[model samples]
Each structure stands twice: as structure tokens, then as C-alpha cells.
Target: MRLPKTAHTSRPWLIHEIAGDFQVEDVWALATPGGPGDLPRLVSQFVSGDFPRGAPLIVRVLWATRWRLGALFGWDRPGAGLGSRVTSLRQRLPESVPPGPGPANLPFTPLYLLADEWAAELANGTVHTVMHVGWVPDGAGGHRGQMAVLVRPNGWFGAAYMAAIKPFRYAFVYPALLKRIERQWHAGTGGAPPLHT
Candidate 1:
């Protein structure tokens, strides 16, 4: 579910050190409740891009439309993406931080990995954005996963693009994505639903 910005800001996530210039565009409490060991499974699922395949019809259509528009406008061309439009976040990371598992299906590049957190980044003409997944205490003696999206717009075009997609993201994309995650989580956990706050 959608969460207040504080849900991300209040946490002392290492991402803050490298993404200070980015804004917290969205924070979500994922429905995948489990112990710490489950973090890898969640991260693996994210990297696999299975969630998008399960998105609602409207969300899928909108995504295809966006991709088509991006191609037509050269918004996501190679020259407009990572290392061209913007340098990879890895360049900004301190040597102490270790790299996370590389993406398998998603377009993002792995940024950093920690015991409870993993981050990846993507860049295009419109924006440089971060996708962060974190394991947080569920306040009932176990832990669950949360996801946050941080963005740094390229310019007026970037800002406008983000604004235009906000409604579709919240109203259609996220809800469907969450339900898919929940369904898969249950499927793996013997069909028991996770506790939701």
C-alpha cells in the first residue's frame, strides 16, 4: 500500500548517502511478510520482472503505450540512458559498499547490497531513478519487505513525464503489482495470507 514519505525518510537507509539529490517519489509496504531469510527471495522476484507480467490489463496496456511513446520520442534510447544521460550510481558509492546481485530481467543496474536492503537504478532521458527494497521489522516479532522509488528528473521533460504518470502509477500499477506479490507470496507459503497493517 502507499505510504507517507516518512516511511522512507525516517529510516537510516544507506541509500540516503548516495541518493541525497533524489526525491522520494513513492513508498510502498509490500505484502510479502516473512523472516529475514526471505529477503533474497523477494529481491530475486523483483529482479525477475514477474510482477509486471501479472499486472492488470489496464496497467499492462499503459506500460506498453509508455514504452511505445518512449521509443518514438527517443526517451529511452541507449544514448539517453545510463552512463550517457547520467552516470551509474555505483560511481558514487564508497568502496566499502558491496554490489548487489545483478538484475536478471529488469533494466536497472545493481547499486549496492546490504543485509536488509538492496538497491538498483535506471536512467533515461526523462529521469534517473532508484528502486529500493528493504526489510523492516513488522512490529510483531518478524520482518516484512518495503519498496521505495526515488527519482531525479532530467529537466522539464523529466518532471512533466513523472507528473503525467503519477496517477496511473498509484491508481493502477501499484495496486495490481502488490496483489501479484501477495498471491505469489501465498503460493510459496502454503496459501497463508500475510498480515497487513
Candidate 2:
């Protein structure tokens, strides 16, 4: 379910230090329940999960439409992306966060990774955004994932783009995405995920 911005702002997340200028666009709870040791696997599956092959029809259509529009508008041109249009958030990662290229095959670049948290970033013609995930205690002696999206729009254009898609994101994209994540957590991994430092 969609969570209030405070759900993300109140955490001691390193993203607050790295992207203080960005707005908290959305926060959602991932339903992947497991133990403390499950964080690494959680992050891995999340970044690697395939959302296009068999996602709900609306999701696939949205993905296709988005890519087509980006292609048509030069929204994802190389000049508009990381290290070009804007600086990478990696510049702000403190010593407490590991400085490494995040996992391969994902759309976003990993800013940093800790045992319980991971933050990645992406930039296009429209916006520079951060996707931060944390492993939080479930209050029932287990743990689940929480995701927060932080964004800094390019200008009025960015703001308008965000406003236009807000409803579709909340109504369609997130729920289906989270459901896939929850399903993968329960069925994909054979056992405990390998640890990450």
C-alpha cells in the first residue's frame, strides 16, 4: 500500500544525506516477509526481477508506451542521463556507504549498499530520481522491505510530467509491481539468499 512521505523521511536513511534536495515522491511497503538475514536476497531479487515478460497487461502496455515516448522525445538520450545531464548521487555517499557500481542488468545505478539498505539512481530528460530500499523490522519478529522514491524534477516540465502520471502510478504500477515482488520472495529463491557486505 502507498505510505505517507513521513514513512520515508523519518528513517535514518543515507539517501536523506545524499539527496536532500529531492522531494519524496512515493513510499510503498513491500510484502516480502522473512528474517534479518534475508536482506541481501531481498535487494538482489528486487533489482533483478523481470517486470515485462509476464506482468499484468496494463503494466506491460505502460512500459511499452513509456519507452516509445522516451524514444520519440529524446527523454532517455545518453546526454540526458547520468554523468551528463546531472551528477550522480554517488558523489554524496559517505564512508558508511559502500562505493561501488550497483548490480548489473538494472536500469538504475547503485549509489550505495549496506547490509540492510540499498539506494540506486537514474536520470532521464524528465527527472533525476532515487530508489531507496530498506529492510525494516515487521514488529512481529520478522522483516520486510520498504521502498522510497525521491525525485528532483528538471523544471516545470518535470513537475508536469510527474503530476500527470501520479494517478496511474498509484493506481496501477505499484500494486502490480509489489505483488510480483512478494510472489518472487516466496517462490523464486530456494533458501536463504547469499549475504552482502
Candidate 3:
């Protein structure tokens, strides 16, 4: 479910230390309920990029449209992405933190991984954004996932792009993706065995 901005801001997340310049774009309480150990599963599933495959048709269409638009406008070209348009957040990460397992399904680059949290990033002409997923106590003696998106807009085009997509993301993309995650959770496919240290 969509959550208030405070739902993300109230927590003292590690992301805050590194991404102080970014703005919180959205926060949602995921529907994947399970034990704390399930966090790895959630992260794994997200990295797999399966949600978009099962998302509603409208979402798929929108995604395709966005990609096409990006290509046509040179919005997602190499020069507009990470290490070019903006330096990666990995440069600011503490040495103690290990890089994430990497993304399989999305265009994002893994930033860092922790016991209960994972982060990945994406950059283009429009913005450099981070997707952070964390496990949180659900107040019922169990745990669920929470997802937040943070972004640093590139400039006027970036801000305009974000504004243009906000309604579609909230109305179609996120809701469809969340529902898919809930289904995966109930089906016991939302997670994987914990990664060995």
C-alpha cells in the first residue's frame, strides 16, 4: 500500500547518510509477510525482475512506451547514465558495506546489500534514482517489506520527466507490482534461501 512520506523519513536508514541530496519520491508497504529471514527472498525476487513481467497490461504498455521514448530522445544512452551523467553512489559507500548481488531483471545497478536491506540505482538524462527495499517488523510478530524510491533530478528535463511519470507509477505500475509480489509471497516464490556470507 502507498504510505506517507514520513513512513520513509521517520526511519534512520543508511541511505540517508549517503543520499542526503536526493528527495524521497515514494514509499510503499509491501505485502510480502513472513519472518525477518525472508528479506533475502524479497531482495532476490526483486532483483529477478519478475514483477514487471506479471504486471497489468497497462503497465507493460507504459513501460514499453517509456523505453521507446527514452531511446528516441537519447535519454538512456550510455552518456546519459551512471559514471557519465552522475557518479555512482558506490563511490560514497563505506568500505565495510559489500556491493549488492547485482540486478538480473532491471536496468539498475546494485549499490549495497545488508542483512535487512538492499539498494539498487538507475541513472539517465532525467534523473539518478535509487530503489531501496528493507525488511521491517509488521507489528504482528512478523516482518514485511518496505520499498522507497529516492531521486536526484538532473535538471529541468529530469524534473519534468519525473512529474510526467508520477501519476502512472502510482496509479498503475506500483499497485500492479505490489499485487504481484503479494501473490508471489503467498505462493512461496517471493524469496530464496539466504545468501551465504
Off by over 4 Å in 1: 189-197
> Where in model 3 is the C-alpha error above 4 Å?
190-197
Q: Compared to the true structure, candidate 3 yields what TM-score?
A: 0.93
Model 3 residue 182 lDDT? 78
TM-score against native, each model: 0.91, 0.90, 0.93
Please, what are the lDDT tens digits per residue for candidate 3 over residues 1-197? 88998888788778888888999888889888889788888887776655456567898788778888888999889999989989999989988898877666556888898877888888888899888888899999999999888999889978888888888877887777777777777886743211100
Candidate that beats the other on TM-score, 1 or 3, i.e. the better one: 3
Q: Model 2 off-target regions past 4 Å? A: 100-106, 190-197
lDDT of 2 at 186: 83
- Give one digit per residue, the lDDT tens place, for model 1 in 82-145: 8887989898888889987756655678898798899988888888998888899989888888
Candidate maximizing TM-score: 3
TM-score ranking, best first: 3, 1, 2
Worst 10 residues of 1 by lDDT: 188-197
Instruction: Give the TM-score (vs. native) of candidate 1.
Output: 0.91
Query: lDDT of each structure?
Result: 0.78, 0.76, 0.79
